[model samples]
Target: MLKKMLKYLSSLRFTIVLICLLGVMFIVGLWVPQQRLLKTVYLEWQKNTPNLVAFLDTFGLTNVYASPVTITIWALFFLNLALVLWQRWPVVKSRITVTDAKIVDPVTASGYPFRACYPILPELSGDAVFAALTKKGFTLRGTTEGFYGIKNRLAPLAFMLFHLSFFLVLLGGLVTVYTEFIGFIDLAQGESFQGELGRYNTLPIPKMPAVGSIPKVSFVVQSIEPKVTRNTVTGIDVKLTDASGSTHLVGINTPYNTDNSSFVFKHLGVAPLFVLIDPSGKEVQGAYFKLDVVKGRQDTFRLGDFLFTANFFPDYEFKDGAHTSKSMEFANPVFLITVELNGKAIAEAPIARNGSMAFNGFHLEMRDMPFWVRFYVDKQRGLSILYAGFALATIGVIWRLLFYRREIVGSVREVDGVRCLVVAGRSEYYKSLAEDEFVRLFETAVIGK
Candidate 1:
């Protein structure tokens, strides 16, 4: 039963069918928005068609690559390739080794696809002919009749390399899927982050709980600079210092990599520090509120039975009885705030940076506006193995294409006192090119001399 199962799994038909199924799944992946990569887009789809989204998510169709069914299929594919390689090892080994007993008859081998027989100069010796063939990269084994030879003898090993690469690539992908860490966090300038799960704003679960451990890394953002074009942030540059007091520059596309983890910039916004003071002149509560307000959009929060709706204007302007921002760059920042008590508006006004306002026996102060940036941190596993697989695949392809397997059989015969050399050759690949080479060997190695 085990033998039958191995044979069934290693069959070429099974491999082909598995590949076709994976291709279909790849197409489905292109059509569906995966939650991990495009949360906002997937959320939009969920909002638009909740029923369809729920069904797809339930069946794991929404995330095809990481789905249990797809992962099983990948595991099967890897097993099939491995079994196929093992079953074909004898054939590959046979091709790799050349023995004198196997090619004892040069006369019979002369009938090969590429064959030649010609007269040689009497002065030419077996050593001379062998030396010529050696210069042309042929390994020869001498026999009673003549010589049996092969060129590019290692060419057959390329197939094994190809199979090994495929196995490694699958192994790497599986390791990464089950053991990687992906999360996001928001940090204001001067705010530090230690590698802890609780500090992350969003964390995606992995397939397995074998993520090893989180990297020992800590960094504080020193400053943030955004390159704005037409009131839109085109790019963001951040300077940060690590726990070791080393500073590194990170940007939207340039992430800071350390301890096999990468810190990538995702989003940026304004975080205003607010302090609420009571009538007794004592600080009631205080914290930095990172609001997602852009272009005069209102964001609301609750503080001690009071609702505060605030709009942020970087480069504030008061024109035509309306509040607006001239640009997205942080300059002359101000907050247009409306405070409500028991759902009734109590105070509505603008508060500049470092300014204070009073309403209903309470004072609210805008302490400072600091830029906050969101970072998507990733600690990926098995990337080195994946890259090694790619390198091996490339080497296998180049080896197979550049150095093809070919064999030669040669004999020295005498007819009517005229000494002549007979040589025959054949190539498993690139027959036309090998034919030319065969002719050249016959002419230059024997007849030409």
Candidate 2:
């Protein structure tokens, strides 16, 4: 059964199937985006083919690589490779032995071509032939009566080394699939805290503030020690507390990793707010009158239940009389805000650079912003396996490619009245070169006519 299995794996059919499968996988890799957010894909689909968005969502084709079906295909490919290697081992070993064996007193055949050129060549003594071949760039070794010479025996091993390298590459890929992870974390500037170690359902922020109340949902900043020389400091140290009453400290350069998940510091910014309440039992945040100053420019603000972020231009001019921002950059950030508690607008104000809005009974203000940081988390095990496989493959390639087994056999025998030198030589690699050297050895042999 083992032999049969090995024969099947090493057969041409199995190799052809493997090649075809690999080709399909390559096509899939090229056509399908490996990893992307579902929402992003949905949005793109909606933009292109709104009708098919629902259908596409039913199948997880957007992130093809992570999809269960794609992973299964990769698994099958690995299995095929393993089977092929297992089946070919015996044959490979047998060839190795045959190629390394020393040949001595090799029988000279009557129909040999070399004998036709020099009929007495085969009749020459083995020692004489060995000595002649050695002078012709062949390294002759073994006993005087039974000698061997070998040349360029390392060429055939290249195929084995190449195969080993390929195997290693496949293994590395498999390891990466299981062990590697990729995720993003968003952080605000000047914020310091050890990020969450495990996957948690809590929001990234301490609290979700009302639309316009930025102060209610601000980062807890401990301190800001500015560096005079460098563009950025090594890291900011901050403490974090979870609901379970655990505190952890983290820095910019030094992040916190738990359960193979990591949190990285990303960016920092401040969000200002304004609040307003009117007499009609309703409340509004931020005044609309302040919008006139940056009418043509971009405006961004959060109100009681709505968040509005927009770009503005200083020399605002619109083709259809609609005010549009000049560029996306927030050179002059402003918020012309208005808020309503129920159905009535109660407060209105203009929030300018580093300003806040307030209204009756409820007051809102801008506070210091914190740094925003990004983190990545993953739970794949294939990455490590793939790396290990790659290492093994590299070793295998070097062993098989750089090293070769060589052997030469020469035997002397008395034939007729002459001391006949019979040297039947074959090389696993470089057969032509080996034969040339053998001929040279025969030419140098002293023959008694």
Candidate 3:
């Protein structure tokens, strides 16, 4: 039963099926969006067919990669790999032993002749022949002659290492899926925020109750520098004040570390001013907007029935009856404002030079402009297992490429009272070269010219 099980596990067909299944799973994972809400997919699909959207969401296909079914498939793949290794190990070990007499025999019982025969010298014992074969680079082992002659016996073991590396990589991936969280945070110039531990950061909505629910970790912005001529921050200087009143400074590529908190300054942007007025025509509250050079226009805040948006121009010029921007350096900043009330256009105006847009007893003005700082928070899980797996894979490739086991064996026997020498060579790679070397060594030993 054990042998049958081993045979089944080590069969090439089994591995091929496992590999094909994994390939299908990987392609599906890539094509199907991962870690997204079913409601978002359903809403998108509702634009066409609400029924299909409901069906897809009901089946949990929106985030298939992280679904329990997909994870179970991957688990089976790992099990198959483990079984394959377990089944093949005994065969590999058996092949490593060279005691099989058929491998060294000169003549078959059917009288089929072998190649390159040499007369065995009387002075040369089987031990001497084995020693000569060793000199010729054949791996030999046994207490007595005719016991064993094996070369490249460990060649099959190379697969074991390769498979182990793959297993480690899979294990690391599982760890990442279960324990690690990834998210993005957007920080504008001079703006300070205590980021959530695992949430993707975006523009904070003013007066939103969810914004208040975010945990407060004391962070202060020191400076935000331009990464390029663009509006993005090349780097940022951050001062993190811990709960114990200890402050640590961190910058780009330099992380601030605390006992429970780790911070990395990721990105920076320009914070533009957005104002909203109440129904009584008084400025109630304003929201700060972070603008990216690539993102041209941003949505506005609503006050009562009026909506206001801000368009920022680093340097503005009029070309072909439209505003054109030259650079993002804020050399000449301008705002193109549009106000709408009750779904009707109220007034359109350009508010430049710290001015206000007044229409119908309403006043909107740029109040306060502050720079924003974006930082990432992380909790380390000791050493990253994925990185360690990658390291092991690199080492395995180097080992297989540079280190090859080789062995040669020569057996001598008196054939018609003539000294005959037979040599066989084996290597993990460059077998022909090993064979040539064996021939040369045997020629030198048998027939000295």
Candidate 4:
């Protein structure tokens, strides 16, 4: 049973199946809204599709990367690759091995897969043939009776490197799974984030490590400037102030990285600060509502049974009883707000910046419309290892494709009473190309050919 299992584990078909399984998991991960990465989106999805969400949750598909099934698959993949390398190591080593001082006896033309016999001058010795092989880029290892020559001796190691690269990639993935943490945080312009556990929009994944690894640093999003290209908002350039008061300009492509964590731009939206005053004149609630709204779209939130729906107009304009934005620029901004109580529309009005609207003896004030940017923070330590594996894989591909492992044995022997040089060569790959090279080597070394 052990032998059979090892054979299965080391088989090429088993490796391909594992790769296909990983590919399927990757596709599933892309299709499903991962709860760890987008908690709010996942929650909304769960609310709308409770049955589907339940099925996904039961199978751990919602958090596929952190799922036990995913971890098990990775573990099995690592085991299989290791077994394959182990099973092939001895054979691969034997093929690539060469002793420089070992002598090889001369053989006839029929001895090798590709061979040629050339008549030489009587004065021309075996040394001449050996010298010709050396000048033709073959390393001469011995010249006792004949000569043993090899070229691209290290090319066979490329096969081992290919497998080792895969092993490193799997190891890197395992490292990331155990040590990495990801979370999302939103900070409106001028607001500060102290890098606390409670500041994240959703709790970070792998909560235990996140608690320890999160950088104890604070920074404020000072301002945001959109990078416009051809009148389209391509990205944003953010001015940030760190705890030390040093400022940095960051954007979607360039993240603020520190303490093994990176703050990458996820998205941007409008945040309207609101102050709700009760009829008794007490400040009941005051907070910023980070509404995921864009041009012509509305977003809403609720306070104690009263729902507030708001649509923002940057560069606000009103003509012919229609409210719209003249452009994407924030030259002028306004919010058309509606209030509903118990499913009945109580009030509706368009409020300018810092304007107030009233309904049912309650006052709601729009303090400001500040752009908020969401940052995806992650502490992923395995990235360097993964990059190294990729580098190794690239090198292996180049070496294996560009260099061919070949061996040539030449001997100065007597055939039918005529002194001749018997040249034989073999290549593990690119047989035709290697045969052409063999002809070139003999032509270059032979004085009479």
Candidate 5:
């Protein structure tokens, strides 16, 4: 039963079917972004596909790569490839005879698709020919009747190696699906942010076997300097302590790399600090209102039954009846605000930096304009595994393509008073190329005087 199962799994037809299914699934999966949780996917899809939300969730289509069914299919693929490699290992071993082969028929090798016969010099010694083949990368073993000789002796190993790499890639992907942590958090300049899992809105939402422990991380934004030419950050300074209790400075484009986590700058924008004072001389709100111009139709917030919306300009300019900024530099930063209470318009006017407005018993003031930086945090455990797999795959490809496995079978046979050599060669694949290689060998080692 085990043998039958392996045979079925390792069959070429079965492999082709599996690959086709995976290809279709890959196309389908493109509709949903990778590494995002199903909940997030559902939310995004519901905007135009409210009815499909239930279907997507029910079928695990949102997080297709990490879905239980897809993972199982990938696990099976890995297993199948492993079994196939194991089954073919003996064939490779037989072709590369460690002991002298009883019958050497290089030209008739079943795996070698092409064969050739060549003439040789009468004075060419067997040892000399052996030396030439060895120099050209061939391992020779066996007697006349059962000899085995091959160039690129480890070519079969490359076949196995490539398959092994593919398996590791799948396993690595599986590990990433379950073990990696992806989250986004925003921090204002001089604001502190924590790295607790609870503090983050992580993606690909943990499903099975739970996740490994994540390192504790926290950092305070020190300062932000924008590049006025393009409204991008020139640099952002952040101060954090290492595990050794040493201070380190992080900046934009400079990633903070830890053992298992990485913190990289995502973006930086302005945050306007505000103070809202209610009646009875009580200070009600004193905090930064994060103004993200990239978020939606309006940048707004609410405090004490009052809603606020604003159009901001770093270098204020009114051009052609449209709100525009003269430059990214904050030479004359101002904002046009619209305030509403219970859906009734309260105020609409332009306010400069450090400006204030009072209505009834409440007072509102913009104290400072501080830039906020958002860093995307990633916790990865299988990155090394994925890279290792890629490296191995590259080695296997080079070995297989650049140095293909071929064989030359020859023994000196005395013919017509002059002792001459009759050599037959074969190629495992790339028949035409191997034929050319054999011809070169004939001219260089065999027929050359």
Candidate 6:
């Protein structure tokens, strides 16, 4: 019973079922926000939706692939492939290397390509029939008991290669799911970060060994180039320095590739520098604040015992009794600033370009605003394996399409005191076409001539 189970597990139907299950799992994973998201973003999501946080925590939905369900599915699929390959290896390998062909069974030979009881000339011997077959350039691999003719014999390897590539691709994906690291890097135009152990942060909320074998990389944000329309940051210029001291310019979609890491662009938004001073004219707080995470370019922050709120309007408008930005560009920039203390509104007014507000013994001013971009740094250990899978799959598919494997077998046999040559043909695929070609070749090369 166990043997029968093993056989079934290695069958094509079993593999198909496992793959279908994996596909469904992959779709579900996509629908659920993955743990692969930025740590701050994911945490913010959980914080904002407490009920969803409980649900995701209960079933590990946030970390779908790393969860038990997905991992088990992948493991089973891998096992199915390994077993199927183990069972099929001998057949394909032998077909590729076999020099002498043996007679096939009646069941196999009786299919589409066959001719039975073809008469031998009454005076001609069986040896003469084979000599005729040889004259037709059959490339005989037969002893007179049976005759074997083959063309493109090695093409069967395409089947093996395609299956092997599937294994490689899946293995690469599994490795990446388990060990790959994706991180977000934030910087001002002139800011930079080192790629060392102490200088970076990654998503999936960095585990016990924080650094964890990540490749050393460092980069400085140079400048961000704006898009023509609306004048937003479309691309960025960066200077990257690897551990080897090599400096390279990087930009959006143009990542610097190292042995195991890739640095890609992720987030882009605006940062407005603001400074606040007490009534005594002494500076209190100053820094560049990001507005990307805050929807509608508005956010509330607490400083000292005061609550400060900023409402940004890139192109100020009060049309149709609605306060909205006409465009994303800073055409006529305006900020509506409001101050409150202990839930009581102290001051509220719209501040224009080069704006300032003085209220409740504090002075606030907008200094400058600029665009900044974030980079998604990735490090994968099995990228080579993934590339190999793609190459092999392509080669296998092309070979199968262009150079299919086929063979014809014939034998001189006497039945019921009548002697004749019995012929049969088979192909790796495209059976009907192979059969038709076999008949035409045999008739033209031997019988007709």
RMSD from true fold, candidate 6? 6.0
> Taking the candidates one at a time, how many backbone clashes does each contain?
0, 68, 19, 0, 9, 1
Q: Model 1 off-target regions past 4 Å?
A: 1-5, 38-58, 102-107, 118-126, 143-145, 202-208, 228-235, 252-254, 274-287, 293-368, 412-421, 447-449
Model 2 misplaced stretches (Cα beyond 4 Å):
1-12, 32-39, 46-63, 66-73, 98-101, 104-141, 148-184, 189-259, 264-367, 379-384, 402-449
- Model 6 is weakest, by summed lDDT over 10 consecutive residues, at 203-212
Q: Tell how far residue 331 is off in model 3, in angstroms.
A: 5.1
Residue lDDT tens for model 6, 1-449: 99999888778898788888778777767776665654576778878997987798678778876778777877877788889778778887887674653555322565435453465666777666666656655556766567677667677778778878988898787676566766666666666667654445444343322334665666666566444246454555666554456777777778877647777766666667778889999889887866562236567766667787888777789889766777765576677778898999999877674677888878887787765666676877776788899999999988866787666677767767776666777766676676667666655443434
If both were scored by TM-score, which would come out higher, candidate 1 or candidate 5?
Answer: 5
TM per prediction: 0.78, 0.52, 0.67, 0.79, 0.81, 0.73
Candidate 2 at 136: error in angstroms?
A: 15
TM-score of 6: 0.73
Ranking by TM-score: 5, 4, 1, 6, 3, 2
* Model 3 lDDT per residue over 306-403, tens place: 77665666577767988767766656666777888787878977666567788787777766554555556553332357677777777767666666
Overall lDDT per candidate, in order of appearance: 0.81, 0.48, 0.59, 0.79, 0.69, 0.69
Candidate 4 lDDT over residue span 1-449, tens digit each: 99998899888899899889888888899999999778899999999999999999999999998788887887888888888888888988876778753344435433357788877777776677677677766787766256778888878789889779987787787676567767788888999988887778754543435334665668989997765443467778888999899998879789998777888998878888888888888877878888877656789988656898888877788988988888876667788888999888899988876898888889888887788898888776787888789999999988987886778877777789987777788877667777887787776676732
Mark the regions of model 6 whose C-alpha exceeds 4 Å error after superposition. 27-64, 98-147, 174-179, 196-204, 207-212, 228-249, 280-282, 293-297, 302-305, 317-323, 330-334, 349-354, 409-424, 435-449
Judged by lDDT, which candidate is best? Answer: 1
- Model 5, 1-449: lDDT tens per residue? 98887689998777787788788778778876443545555566677776776677677776787688787787777777777888889997875555654335544545555444445565666567666666766676754333456777777778778878987776677687677666666677777655656655344332322477564676656666555545643555666565455666667767788757777778666788878788677878777877775322358888778888877777788789876778766677787778889898888766777897777677778889877766677777787788889999999898877777677666655546555455667776567777777778755765432
**What pairs collide in candidate 1?**
none
Off by over 4 Å in 4: 20-71, 100-112, 118-136, 203-212, 273-288, 295-297, 301-307, 315-321, 326-332, 340-343, 352-367, 412-421, 445-449
Local error of candidate 5 at 88, Å? Answer: 2.0
Between candidates 1 and 6, name the one with more favorable lDDT. 1
